[model samples]
Target: MKHTYAPIGLYSLCKPLLFRIPPEKAHKLSLRALGLAGSLPPARYVLKRFFSPDTQSLSLFGHTFINRIGMAAGYDKNAQALDGLEGMGFGHIEVGTITPKPQKGNPNPRVHRLPQESALVNRLGFPNDGLDIIAKRIESYCNRRNKRYSGPRPILGINIGKNKTTANAQAYLDYKECFTRLKDVADYITINVSSPNTPNLRALQSEEELEKILTPILDIRQKSASHVPILVKLSPNLEHNTRTGMIQKLVEWSVDGVILSNTTKTSHPWEGGKSGAPLHDATLSLIQETRSRFPNLVIIASGGIGLDGDLQTFIEAGADLIQIWTALVYRGPYLLRRL
Candidate 1:
């Protein structure tokens, strides 16, 4: 045994200390630690041995993923910790729900924890360092690529959104600006129309509105030599009929993939969009429905997943890959090991 007890014991010892701090502050501190650890190979070796999956190969979109699990978006909105994160063992990491221009997202006290539900509620509003800054960082990583940073520089997936001030009618242009700057760096792109905190952001999910926004991006993507994959992040709050309609449209547009959900605006006793336990049933339904509608489209599932058994539910519902955020917060870095 490669000292199995050590990592979990360390996490148990440190858990109370981390939980004592404010959730957002603790999150920032965790990312900083990861960034520092990125430069220490011996530390990474120990961490990887303890947490990384035994089998590290998955095929999707004709590309091989170093593993099946990925760190969902929101963990790295600014692409600041890619090297360190890769060392820790995520098959891929999606960075940003970044906008065309830099933005200060919704004011804090924006994230909340619901221990009762084993969940989280966040209205972080896509705070990011903008596409220009993010693109440069990704290109820099690509230039200095190493074996530790496996599988196409760990599949840089850019998630785009409209600026807080942008009108709903012009949201497509905002996505265009981000795509134009980021296409070269992004292995795949996710058009985010599901964030609950941004005003009218979810309206773009409507079929007529979605076509207006997606049509141009698809045209641009098709014309490009890179032919980078494109995906859409959807909301789980929609009625069954609407969700089915959206899947049909995604197939018709030939989108490269679909992220089954973003967080939802369901109000529990805690404020913000509910994620983790409460989202489990609804998210599964969305995945099951979408999979039935588009058997061939790659589906990346997220929302409300906590335990090892939850992974099987998502897989059975037709998710090609699964993502976890709240569980990572509550379960510590040893999450992948448990899975």
Candidate 2:
């Protein structure tokens, strides 16, 4: 297929305007635009042709990803922007840190930009449209069929979390419900137990607590006719022994993958977890150590990825795949092409 290139310096020219909007508002606006373009046939065609990256594929978890870069969760917590984002050349789009029920998340001004740092600190919690609606949205989008569009389809993963109102002991029920509801639609499922903003959520990262959580989910996966990969997302702030202990539990349960190093609380003075250029070194270290200890484990690296060099660094560090959230915000959609 012939491609129509976007005009040079398009995002550079638009960066100032995007920066002028409040971070959360600008995020919603961009998702709306992408959703609109993705919903319309002509616009979808133009987008796919213009932004599709050169095919660089890999196989994992019994699926082939067209590229190594994925859009991390929280960017499209409701799955509203998959088509446009997929068109923009991401190998996969992981949506939601979804809970059992809808939530308002934290108040406004929860997402802050550190332009000089090329980073973002977010305390948005896990606000989303809940399991039922989000699952349906994904199902409807998947039902559209990939044949209508060119290029390999991007893999879809759903990240699940507990509602803020749920107690730590009851959190497994929330995760189980989300997994039971979303598994059919999701290519993979990520259990998010590491978001710093969620009260006591990170406590679930403990081996004992994680076993309570993963047991039921793994039981269900065992019973189901289909096997969907289940991954755990770990906080970047974990001490060495704590992190490795968690991984040992994961191995014991035979979980499919691990997303190393979510946003960090120590990297900046901000009140929330930070992601961007500052996160690269710590994340890379996590990837290296985790890879060394668990040679065969599938590791998805997130945090602090921006340039092509960062991509190479993660890959060299033994990351099976890399995810971009803050970098996408800083560099624009064109970042995918550059990667």
Relative to the true structure, how large is the alpha-carbon lDDT of every model?
0.80, 0.86
lDDT for predicted candidate 2 compared with the true structure: 0.86
Which residue window of length 10 is worst by lDDT in model 2?
1-10
lDDT value, candidate 1, whole model: 0.80
Query: Candidate 1 lDDT, tens digit per residue, 34-145?
Result: 8777658887676678777645577777567777678888988888777778777788789888998889888988888776566778888888888788889888876666
Q: Over the stretch 55-135, how does candidate 2's per-residue lDDT look in tens digits?
A: 779999998998898999899999898878876778888999999999998887788988877878999988899888888
For each candidate in turn, the TM-score is 0.93, 0.94
Clash pairs (backbone) in predicted model 2: none
- Give candidate 1 regions above 4 Å deviation: 1-9, 146-153
Q: In model 1, which residue pairs have backbone atoms overlapping below 3 Å?
A: 276-304
Give residue 155's error in model 2 in angstroms.
Answer: 0.7
